[model samples]
Target chain A: MIRDKLCAGTALGRRIADSRDRLYRVALAWCGDEMLADDLVQETIETGILKSRQLKDENRLYSWLYRILKNAWYASLRKNKGHETLDEELLADEAGPFSNCQQLEIVVQVRQAIGRLPAEQRQVISLVDLDGLPYCEVAEALEIPIGTVMSRLHRARKGLLGKMTTAPSGAMTANRILHLVE
Target chain B: MENTEYSLDDQTLGSFVDGMLDAAHSETVIRAMDQDQDVRERVHQLHLVKDLMKVGFGHTKAPSAHSKKTRLATWRLFSPRIAASVAALFVVFAAGMLSQPYVNGQPGFPGEMLAAFSPVLSDSDNVILHISESDPQQFAAALLYAEKFLQEHRSQGYQVDVVAHAGGLDVMRADVSPLKLQMIEMLSRYDNVHFVGCANAIRVLREKGINPPIIAGVSTKDTAFDHIVGRLTSGSWKYIRVDSLVDNPGSA
Candidate 1:
């Protein structure tokens, strides 16, 4: 029994370490802050290490782990007095690496569009697009019904498509058509 | 503007592109694409949105390599974003762009680095000073680096986070830290300078039957990596590994 528990613990640790980047990506997409997202992923991994037994099905581990991150983000939100987002002016003023570079500008536009999304929509989008978790896994991660996952993802994609269509910048439909056709 | 031969709602098209559709529904959409140029065009746009998303959020290693199956693999074969800037990965590192000048006799980022990386530095002037060594020289070097960076910067907004973990936890321990007085003085001197102890490290030490008391000025975090990640991603924070600053530390 002791050996089995130790083996299980070792496996869980490896999985947690492997999932760190994925968790970080989703957290970054969810909260829109690299630093906060990193901390959230670390906390989630730490909790997963300690509470591995709570997880009954290893197949659902990513979703279970993501649920912990979702809760941690919410806890962090509460700690900050329920400020879900930074002030738009404040966010606009913040500059990232290579902000002056042209390609970086397209990335900036994409991020700005995501920043404008409602938090729930943002969560599903990040899980789907960034983390590459399917609709079912995303639903499992956020503890929502699969239907909610699909709907939010649909709305999120619609929002992104709206941004692209309006801007006519970045790699949008027009740009693709411009490149695809003679 | 109407194609009577085949049609798909935006939601259905979005699902089909995302591989959320069942095999039968996906095949229907594929047939629609074969007959209608507009269907192909609209599907390409839906895919463009997802590709842009991956590029935007794929900051960590192998940005889009985590998943076992990617329905978008076909689109990647002809992705324009890849052609435009295959080298434009997220978060370009040019800390080397700065002169590794000496600050109070320790190698550190000079003030001129601020102007050199304006948008990245100007947005947030934060530094993380990480030390996990028990060597006295490395410890003193960290102290000097911290005090000098904070003292020399003209902007009061400049902030420093001292993260000590593993063997380096000794630097933040109340009974063990060699420069406890200096740490206390530094803490009192600058409001922006903060010291954090790793709770994970502390707990490990406790399990080993030695619970070293952490200094009063130092706060405890769940893990050092969490604190470090928070600092880096929260803003334009630079990381300084104490060991990298020196080749050999003099024994205590």
Candidate 2:
């Protein structure tokens, strides 16, 4: 009855479609391969549709979907551990190399850096920062305790700082502008 | 007041930057921020890391319309019960739409002006690849994707049509097409693949005294829209508007 709507129209189906891009972005950062990211996103959407009944609260659908995605990602890694790694990168390049490298340099570097992090750390930082999920929601999504989420986030930030961020010395700027009154 | 002042660790500062700090701890960090330049800088750098993560991933795009691939109906691949359900759902959706005004890019036929038409990941066995942009790289990418699709679904015998209209007409033009040899090769290889040039586009070009010759093995159509609507109404065909190499995750 109520669960039936999740399959049909404006609810779960459309929502799954809407989540594809962000999922691809997260998947890309995780795997660093566009083709694999596409496969991951597709798998996530399918799994989301198949397991819609497991989603008890519509409000928590995103977290549930992400959890499913994380699980699927792990499963894929397990499944492909010893498989022949044909250069899908070569096949992907047949579609033409990215011509806008200059425009995408910083973005590519950040993505590559994220790709370089340990899987657990990458997952936490992406869920927390890239996806803007709260610690609780990220914990729920990753199926980890909140403490683990914080620690992984700290490690991920430390990993990224040396590679991506610059320590520009400047006068301290206020996080918020505070006015002094007489 | 109990001295809420405490030493700040990297994790606490990271939490503070992420707004994960509890009230008392947050206040402590805020108070300390006024006194410690290093903490301020660490917080700023943490913020920069977060912002770069957002930006880098924010602007990251897939090469080509990956969503339009033979969708992961892996669930459908396994369970006939669910495949039946999806099939039945499509039947109902198509039936429901027939009674309404048939807009080209309507809800059931979801596609943006320059995005893939098959957002719902339907059971459609074929697609019409479209291009109206004169960009050479774009044309090559679309052709490459179309051929890859043909190779993958060769057994399924999927029908693919490349329709070029307006500025997209250049892709099918003999002298202009950057991928003329590749297009010709693909045309020979996949009998089910159709490459179309819009006469309406040719007329516009002709009006400017530029009568472009279309490549051999390609066909001419009256207008891209007519061909699109005709194929869509007649069969299970998705229309893909090839504007960029980016995987357009748009529903329409």
Question: For each candidate, what is chain B's TM-score?
Answer: 0.51, 0.50
Candidate 2 chain B, poorest ten consecutive residues by summed lDDT: B76-85
The alpha-carbon lDDT assigned to residue B10 of candidate 2 equals 77
Model 1 agreement with the true structure over B1-252: per-residue lDDT tens digits: 122232237667867877889999999999999999988988887777677676566654322222212212110010111111111111112333212335456444344432222211112356776777786555655665576667667476688888888788898887977767667767877898899988988999999999798888899988776566445434456555565444322211
True lDDT of residue A18, candidate 1: 71
After best superposition, candidate 2 residue A105: deviation in angstroms?
A: 1.5
C-alpha DockQ of every model: 0.14, 0.13
* CA lDDT, candidate 1, residue B138: 55
Docking class of 1: incorrect
Off by over 4 Å in 1: A1-9, A86-100, A167-182, B1-8, B61-252
For A39-70, candidate 2 gives per-residue lDDT tens digits of 77777877788777777888887788788878
| Candidate with best lDDT | 1
| Candidate 2, backbone clash total | 4
| Segments of candidate 2 deviating more than 4 angstroms | A1-6, A83-102, A165-182, B1-8, B61-252
Measured on C-alpha atoms, candidate 2 has an lDDT of: 0.61
DockQ, candidate no. 2: 0.13
- Deviation from native of the Cα of residue B175 in model 2, angstroms: 17
